[model samples]
Target chain A: MLWEKEMRVPNTAVVDGKTYATVLGMVRDDRFIPLELVYKPKPGDNVVGIVTNVRHAGYSIELNLPYDGFISSKFTRVSFQQGDLIYGRVKFVDEVGNADITDAKRLPAGKIVDVPASKVPRIIGKKSSMLNVIRDGTGCSIFVGNNGYIWIGGKGNLPLALKTINFIVANAHKHGLTDKVAEYLNEHGGDVKVPPREEEKPPEEKSGLSEPAEETPEPAKEPETAEPSEPSEGEPVSEKEEKDAGSSEEEKQNPIMHSKSAGAAEESGEVKKKGIDIEEM
Target chain B: MEKPELIKDGKRLDGRTPKDLRPVKIEAGVLKEAQGSALVEWGGNKVLAGVYGPRECIPKHGADPYKAKLKIRYTMAPFCSKGEHSRSGPNRRSIEISKVIREAFEPVVLSSQFPRSQIEVYIEVVQAEGGTRVASLTAAAVALADAGIPMSDMVSAIAVGKINGQLVVDLGKDEDNYGESDVPMAVTHRDKQIVLMQMDGLLTREELAQNIDEAIEASEKVYELQADALKKSYEKEERGKLKL
Candidate 1:
């Protein structure tokens, strides 16, 4: 499960055209249901954290990863206690995965259930389809965190809502999970009418299809002459020959790509993006 | 002790051919307290490896700002070996083994991903045979993967030796006791990069090269077992549709 061929993609096991199960769980629609996850924060991630300490300038929040998150007072409006639950989007994540929280707000004293962070997507469903079902049926306002700490609020069916979350976490790998979750909620919810899955259509058909098709083809068109890893099959005009002849120009560009501080920043950003594709694919 | 016949008719004492490897069984997530744990039973050797962290490193001064530190402790239990009970705790042999194991994994474990933290691996040899070092190494690789640490590739280790002028793999107790040479090695699964290699006794340059090639080939089988154990940790039917 390391790679499809000889290509080495860091952090990820499956690459190129092959799909392999990297985590322990059921595989449905080529998507793995992770039994547990080693949580890693990405920028703009909505995370639920418990404030571990109130520092001078910020609060150190435990987002359940190896790294602790920080919420600076400049970004947060309310002062938080050592144990307060904060829900916020990750403003930035450092090279070490330590996150900075912004636009922070305190969640009410509702129950917080921890699910495997990787399963959060299944709980939220595709385009919030399953989330809408839980919200309507149980009448609880649920906040699904990318870091796996789910906050359930509202005076609605608290027990039922928690049960639904657990059910979804367990059966996240099963096919047609959204429909099954709706059926399970309706059966036990009693008189609470859960909406049918038909109401929500796959969001990809509307806009996702066109946008990616346009964006992806652009990069593939100009196969970069750089990194001539794959030797062309009997092609007379290989990029390697051209690059050899234009060694002077290549040397000139090398210093520009390396010397500039902004160029270094861009290079690091590209590396981060490359390594972060471990589980998402 | 008098020298026992290490090999008979080109087969080792255990009746295995020179290229034959000892039976290895690997199981992942054996310990509840550890973030990830694995147990490897290779021939007569029983090695258990447990992994914890990417959490804050203890003795804060040692924390690396750029990557996580790997602290691997390879130890044997008091009653692990046959005959007289060995003293418990980290002896010189165990400490050296621990250092080599850490070095083998350092290149693969994507430590830069979890900077300023520590990843600890504890390898406990519950039963000892001749090739416990490689067994512990194989077990530790699976344990780290079970903990969800991002490793570039899995490592597989094995012992190659020469007994009575004949090359052998996965030396048993008798062969190790009277063998001319023993070479324990670990290699990355995909590329076969030698991460760890330690030799004892004497061998010709050609024999050493042959032993290394044999060790690499044998390690591929070990990697298969490690991968199987990691996958089985999550694929258990009982765990399918987990309750609660």
Candidate 2:
């Protein structure tokens, strides 16, 4: 009894209140036809169709809405073997179920123009400041490729946002980033740019001890040594002059006696007065 | 499984006369997350190993100031078994294999550079046809390189067996059980220094020397493949960074 065909059918069909049936014969294909070959169908579109005959080039999907659709191998990124049941969106439909299938669930708006790879560093700015500014102003998701391919997409004001990005990238090196972006938006009629202000420097008034206390000791020591030696030589000069004849006798015995008067005269102001008196004589 | 006869048309299985080795293919840094990893396939046997670290020693008590400790664990996965699942953990056979692997790598690895640290080597036997321990040792050396660990030279290991009273290189499971003797040896592919060596069963002195010579030749071929794999992984990493 368990081996009967009826028992097998029930087991296959009954699962969680959903009934499934094996295709005894080919059902009518109800898939959609893509309007443009490159364009993908929008998301949440129902794909209902019967594949009539699978071929090497593409699958001929027939829809109940009278549109005969073709799902080409070129349109799909995934490889399909024979007897594969492909699920895709129906882009278009006529009365006769003739349709064209497309794997592209959604079409992206505004593709990136090829920019030079070297220019990317300038466009992105240091730490991505340029990119951050564009994203905040435009409300768009921008992806920049290393090879200079940029992809930008979002809902409203997409064209305007794209134009702004292009302008920013073009004039990046000339005028610098923050100032140029601000000037461009003001001229072209977009959002206004807020400039940051400069910081003020602190005051540099002088304190009391500018010269420093440690340096004062050096100048005072030189004068004290010069004054003490001069007075001692002046007192010895009168005695030496009175004993001049005796001094020559002393000089023969002691060589120290001859130079004592000359030493005393040089230490006192008498040496300058004696030179003036010699010039008069 | 019935064992294949050692001698047929005066040659062993896979049509090699005595002293022929199984083909070896080695690739390093197969796993991106691991510090060092390698996948080595010696004939039908496939083995992979990952080297974790010369990192801070765990359990604190395991730290030794004398030399850098090597924590090695060799394990065979369930799929490696042909029959029922074998008991897991450090079995006597696995422990012996671990000991042999540790000793084989000791000379080649500059352990003194990493004092008070531990290097963890995890060898996984992906497919067990035969000569897994030898394959594991060879793969582990490549894994250590992939992890960027400094080594004196690459360790290359090969299993040489005596079949039909004649020495052969790289015995399969059938040839291993019926073969007369097996000597698994590891050597530094750069300087030809013997790091790890062991023989089981029986062999003459002349036969053992011949086996060692044949093993060294086979290991050099494996070393070339390991170098190529490491080069490819580094190139791939450079490409990934360029994309971002």
Candidate 3:
């Protein structure tokens, strides 16, 4: 019932009392499932890809999706060879999941980590919390693709970063994952600094219990406006209509009374003016 | 071969009652290279199903513009059966089984979600009993779900037949070989809509209809096993991560 108000999206289903995922994924809010089981490309995605083929006009980039991505020669400032690693942003996505990438640059010699595209958000964490811990603690410069490919470079601890990422992917569906990941990172000799998670919004919002409280006032107001419109439309009056009809009738009367009083005031003023004019005559 | 006792009293050759199904074990994500893979052991049948794509359709010409094409290959190994060595390759029987399996899955798989793509399912019968087609389909459905292919609902299958004049669910190889009639059926458990149904022998109209209901009823158990297997695979990985 809590997820019905907030987390219910395309890939989620409600069975009995619990929300179940229809796709092969952790029980995450459907909105956060930008990367589906198969990565469907969206515009403005920062992507890491392997350049599989370099044509005269463009490069065919493999982003781990079913369809390969194409980067036109005009979009890139420098030429890329086959097998070169490139990091870019998705510029366009067609009706199918094919992507046209832009702003691509060759990445340095480093390891490319592949994860399930759906788990990309977990690796990134809330507000990049996990990413910052991995980056700051291991001192690795990391570039993450929404398509589940991660590029790690610079002189940071790559193994630690990878282990932390793997751990995040494994337990992506668990609650309080950030703290557990922080503990794991610290235990593994990575000097990752974990920002205090307590500063974040409390557990009520995370558990989604607080959402209905925010939502209750919304439905209460809808019935009030709907009550007057129903009678005017000559539709059958239901129980809800009958319930709010009293307040709606009062609201209707107040507006009519204001108009009637204003009309009376104008008439009385005109009569007084006429009386004054006749007296003068 | 002499006619063996297919059923005695209320039990079949495998010592299962008329309503009992063979033990079904399923494991998901078994192959690293496949997008999704599953192994299903139903009775003596060992079926491995692997899924690839919603990727670009090969040969360009075979691609469907509006929906992803489903290519299914249901094959059995040469040494899968008991008697003589079976020949490997797409024989007429495997080809027919492949088509029916594909048709069974077509309505459930949300192929329209991916245009100009193809999802290939390879169901290899490592060992065969009587109900390899149903077992392969059971595994393929799991593999598709494990691969994250969008499906409206999980499809499950079972075989039912009249063995020794007694209606039984999930016929064994000997029972199927000697039974008067056999019906292999696949159904979407949520709606009980029969996606695949085949009859191999004669039956009364009432018996045919009743066997369909029996197969649909038996498929619910198969559906539960598939769901549990898919979840257990992930749960095992999660537990391993926690141990770390």
Q: Predictions ranked by TM-score, top down?
A: 3, 1, 2
lDDT of 3 by residue, B38-85 (tens): 999999999999999888898889888878999999988998988554
Maximum-TM-score candidate: 3
* Alpha carbon lDDT at B217, candidate 1: 91
Q: What is the C-alpha lDDT of each candidate?
A: 0.68, 0.52, 0.70
- Model 2: per-residue lDDT, tens digit, B150-244? 45456778788787777788888777888888888887764577877888889988888888888889777666666555544432322111111
Say which docking band candidate 1 falls in: acceptable
Each model's TM-score, in the order given? Answer: 0.75, 0.46, 0.78
List DockQ, one per candidate, in order: 0.28, 0.01, 0.13
Model 3 regions more than 4 Å off: A1-8, A12-22, A25-36, A197-281, B1-3, B238-244
For model 3, which pairs clash?
A137-A192
Instruction: Determine the iRMS, in angstroms, of model 3.
Output: 25.7
Least accurate 10 contiguous residues by lDDT in model 2 chain B:
B235-244
The fraction of correct interface contacts reproduced by each prediction comes to 0.19, 0.00, 0.29
lDDT of 2 by residue, A201-223 (tens): 10110111122223222222211
lDDT score for candidate 3 against the true structure: 0.70
Question: Where in model 1 is the C-alpha error above 4 Å?
Answer: A1-10, A13-37, A133-141, A153-174, A182-195, A199-281, B83-87, B238-244
Which candidate has the top score in DockQ?
1
